[model samples]
Target: MLNREFIFSNPEVLKWIDNKFIFVAGDDWYRRRAQDDASVWFKSIARKARRGKNGSTQQGCYAVTPKGELLRFINTSDPKKFTVTMLEALKLWDGVVQDKKVTIPEMKNFDYKVNVPPIDPSKDVLIKVQSRALTEKDGKLERWNSNGKAGGKPAVGHLWIKQAEWQSIVQNFKTMEVGETTPLTKRLIHRIAKFHLIDNTRGEGPAWESKDLKHAKVTLTRVKNGFAIRGMFLLTNQKKSLSHSTELSGEITINQSTARPVSWTMIAYGKHRGEGKYTRNARPGAQPLGFTFEFLPASKIRPIDLVPPQHMRWQRGYWEAEKH
Candidate 1:
């Protein structure tokens, strides 16, 4: 049985909590003396201890999950910082706030970063096999090395594809090389980019899926009118620590699918404008309201996905793929 009370209370003395490396010699004694809640905690600790080949003289313990997620364990001295770090870690693990494109300060200038959704190589192979047909000059049969080299101008239609499949399609596409035996056709590129977006949204909440569940991913931009229904993308991570940065140009579009007629608006982080109906609203959650991109005044009735380009770059420095 696990120690329910000891684990839930966040006991101060982790060692005495019965999950430390020090209890090897007297495992039974420590287990018996420990609170019932401590059992589960102990088993977790014991498992890690075994992995470390028994306890060490090191002062602090390793912060790990029941499944052995190794969070950097620091000495329990700075409770405040630890709490903050832990919350950040949890957010990262579950991809919390992954969709929100935040502005990160840089030494010289700030760069906007996006999270690249997971792609499967096998899907790439399939996309390569299923090439969209296209016409070449004079209606002759077109041949291309890759899908990216094939497609020509689109015919005013859209292809809604899953995230993994779309990535695979992109991966298989190759531009025609100069003087290559087989000249690449224009239709391939058209097929590859044919209004198809990779839907990265899968789980509950914004992080798991794209802002619009229908979209595989979205490109952020300043709103003149509203969002595009074809699709939109948001950042997401399997790990809670997946946070990316974006540059907030003069004003940007915020697509709220729930809002009927979808009231498109903007809120600046830290700016003040002369009082009027243009007053900004509070951040969707608890963030401070900055500036407002009110659509009511413009009467533009701009559709969603019709905004300034949001240069989103994924953070390559912080990628962690689970080992299969």
Candidate 2:
């Protein structure tokens, strides 16, 4: 979050980045496995970095040539330090390119399963999910910040609704009278409660198990030209040491002629307690955490933003979370 709000968000830094380099974002967790030639080549460059010690994470910025020669690498969250590193990298790049000509290598045996795109973009509905921790101040909730670092910026994620699921929702809307309410499908409700609701603001949180979902309920009420959605959920680990209790509310506007959702917005707000292996440091007790979900139509979605959901490493488990 710090890197995103400080470095990437800076217009001046972005200008240098856009003009000098071909930036690519990747998930090091999966890339480290070297499923194909591209990943293998990436590992060769990453192995030279400071964090490249065998079996440890090789996650950081790197300046490399087309033939995979590492020029500069640094792992720092500070914007000034990152900018300095980029400048140094550019100087080295200028020298290397002038001395030797490098050609891009043709990739063979690319791993599609490692970083899969959206499942059937024509039929799937994409929703952007943003999460952040909140602190109560002046009798109202505000973004949680610690000494101008961490927890201030929202963490982003994605959610996909399958064709059949969305079609069911639209059909339900058509059959209901104005103001009449209907519960969401068990599959959809459990999927959200078990996977999407968590404290990912700090880091990657563990997915809730089926047994951990103590309570999950959501409903949609037909309204004027749309539907009103409301729900509540409670999830706890097997040990009952960690838990999240949240209330959700949202509005979905539909295209009357096509019976498709034109806009969908939802918010989940409640108290969260405990932490996971990757996501540590609790706030002493239950603390306020919030999440917002916004639908992004096909036209609005960019190719870079089409990355799969976090839990999608195991595609079957993610798509059928309710069953598991």
Candidate 3:
């Protein structure tokens, strides 16, 4: 997360730092636990920035309290301003990013007249997404079944993409064999999110297991406006042959409607394996590992369609197709 920690000359951030605040610059914050001494949290959502890609060196400061309270969120502007605000309680400056040029995505209405699979957003149309890594690894998690055999392999890969779609998504996907630079299209991410939403409508799973919840410190709590089934748990997993195992502790939330999760969040924290395409720094891996399910009515969505990757590519190559 944070590659360097400086003894702040300014007393504002310093106080939090002294009180155990941590500063990080990446989405890694969402994956790992906040530092032990961190009373304040600062993270940068800088995922990646490249041409024809959805990634960008996030130019924002997402400052929050230790107890998970929003303090400041400044995107694509002078980040140092955040430090100034931290110094003053009443003083807060935000929403100072460069104005994004307005552009509209080509929208296409689906052929409803034909036998387009009738879908009901509500009810059983739930998006049951297990922890991408923890959910279905075919015992490749190196956790319970460290043998790394081909047992519980998922039908799809992370980002919930099917094999056919993945091939198309990676069509324009360029990368350097030797260098660290890699690129991903912006449309791809959005499509993946859309796919996740659609594919999940065809499944079932829990935000977490009762067995895991049994060990968690479950409680009834209020979030925003509604009641929630909140729980905290410290979990450990190891293979019998391994010398040491991994330990994780995190909080989970199951919003109103116990029988049907209205909106729930589950995050788990553990050691960092420093394994992945890009290991930015050395920090304990805090994974948002858990099952999350969400459902939405078609009426609530935008006026567009989930067309094939080829269609999008053709649109991009078409004369009127402007750069996003």
lDDT of 2 by residue, 1-324 (tens): 544447777777777777688788888877876477878888888887756567569887888887777889977767778899989988888888453566766877778677554466556778888999899999988988856655556888888789889989888878889999999888888777877898887778888888998888999999988889999998889897799999999999988887667988999999999988877776768899999999888777887668778887777777887888
Ranked by TM-score from best down, the candidates are: 2, 3, 1
How many backbone clashes are present in model 3? Answer: 12
Arrange candidates by lDDT, highest first: which order? 2, 3, 1
Which portions of model 1 show Cα errors greater than 4 Å?
A: 1-60, 63-172, 175-206, 209-231, 234-324
In candidate 1, what residue range of length 10 has the lowest lDDT sum? 196-205
Off by over 4 Å in 2: 2-5, 9-15, 48-55, 96-108, 119-121
Better of 1 and 3 by TM-score: 3
* TM-score, predicted candidate 1 vs. hidden true structure: 0.17
- Deviation in angstroms for 61 in model 2? 0.4
Q: Please, what are the lDDT tens digits per residue for candidate 1 over residues 135-211? A: 23465434311232212111111121233433332222223222222211222222222111211111011122222
Worst 10 residues of 3 by lDDT: 199-208
For model 1 the local lDDT of residue 246 reads 17
Candidate 2 or 3, higher lDDT?
A: 2
**TM-score: which candidate is best?**
2
- lDDT, candidate 3, 20-128, per-residue tens: 3365433322222223212112222222121112332334445544334455454432325655555442232133133222333342433222212222333322222
User: The CA-based lDDT of model 3 is what?
Assistant: 0.29
